[model samples]
Target: MKPQKKKYIFHPKVIKNYRGNPDLLRIHLTPEYTKVDFGYVAKDIYINGGWIRIAPETFIENKITKQRYTLVNAENIPIAPMHHYFETKKDWRYFSLIFPPIPQNDCLLNIIEVKNGTPNDFNYYNIELKMADGIELF
Candidate 1:
């Protein structure tokens, strides 16, 4: 028959809030691993020219109007950064962002690292295709 293709049974929405440098980067979002719920508040960890901004507590969960979408007051966010070599490589340190699929509802993403690195800046880090069960399952 050869007509079967379906995996990733709801398991993706990570946010490892980073755990290094100058303190204040500790969020243990859990949803079996990382679905967000670390309860943010500890701030302090930024680097613009050297690349280092690990702030995650973002949002995008709309399970039938249970709304939880955020881009920090969104105003034209769309900074697709999959590979431009992150601007010709700066030692490339983990990069991911290719958003363009949202219709299943349930999104809550963020990356509030600022130093004015404009480009319609929407922060960084990415992933969230499917993952829903009963709200914040940790």
Candidate 2:
């Protein structure tokens, strides 16, 4: 039997074009360019000091084998602001929007839009969390 591939879970609440506009809500996932990959080994997005942080997942070592493995907490899974690429612009080709799993907390995210360009080319789409009343957390 073939090894099962790990499935990535996306949060329902995703803010697209999420740069300083809280009311301008777009569809969570767009098919235009949804196959972009960010080469993240093992990381989780969390709110810290009014900013979204992408860091390595905490893992516990196995006593017998002494091997480190990622802990399966709620944070280990990838949430909203999934992956997307834009084909409209001539110069830019790929970009991504990442969101944390925990939506209830006062979260802040820096939308790092990586544009495929020469030498050094990239853009940032900073997004701040603003939860609506009665919005359920995932």
Candidate 3:
């Protein structure tokens, strides 16, 4: 019999609201969908030519269902949080970073933290492909 696949959960931390830009990029505890709850403001950085930084803003918990939403969009959408799936490893974990369908130049998605684990230490899992408009997802 084949070994059972281990399922991993993604808990989102930050969501970026591009202010009319639909490239919904997000970072967090798990790798999953980029919802409005995880929305954040884009921060300008002066590194690697230049980049945008997103930070977590608010945490909302459902009173009855106990569901939590990160509050990414100006008009919040009620969604059940989700995470990516990966086979379990002793030390390594898998995640999926999502961005909006639209492309941005020199843009990238990064995993910031792993819940109950180390912080500020990141490993690259996937790379965003470049769009037809000459912009690449980082």
* Candidate lDDT values, in order: 0.31, 0.27, 0.28
The number of clashing residue pairs in each candidate reads 6, 0, 20
- Considering lDDT, where higher is better, how would the candidates rank from best to worst? 1, 3, 2
Error of 2 at 112 (Å): 1.2
The TM-score, computed over Cα atoms with residue i paired to residue i, of candidate 3 is 0.19
- Per-residue lDDT for 22-61 in model 2, tens only? 2223212221211112222111122221222122342222
The sequence of per-residue lDDT tens digits that candidate 3 reaches over residues 43-138 is 223222222223333333333334334434322322224222222222122223332222122233332323233332122223232223232223
Model 1 residue 11 lDDT score: 37
- Candidate 1 lDDT over residue span 14-111, tens digit each: 54434422211222233122222122222233232233333233343444445443333211122323112222222333322222223333454443
Best by TM-score: 1
- 10 residues in a row with least lDDT, candidate 1: 31-40
User: What are the clashing pairs of model 2?
Assistant: none
Q: On lDDT, who's better, 1 or 3?
A: 1
lDDT of candidate 2 at residue 23, scale 0 to 100: 24
The candidate that wins on lDDT is 1
Preferred candidate (TM-score higher): 1 or 3: 1
Error of 2 at 70 (Å): 15
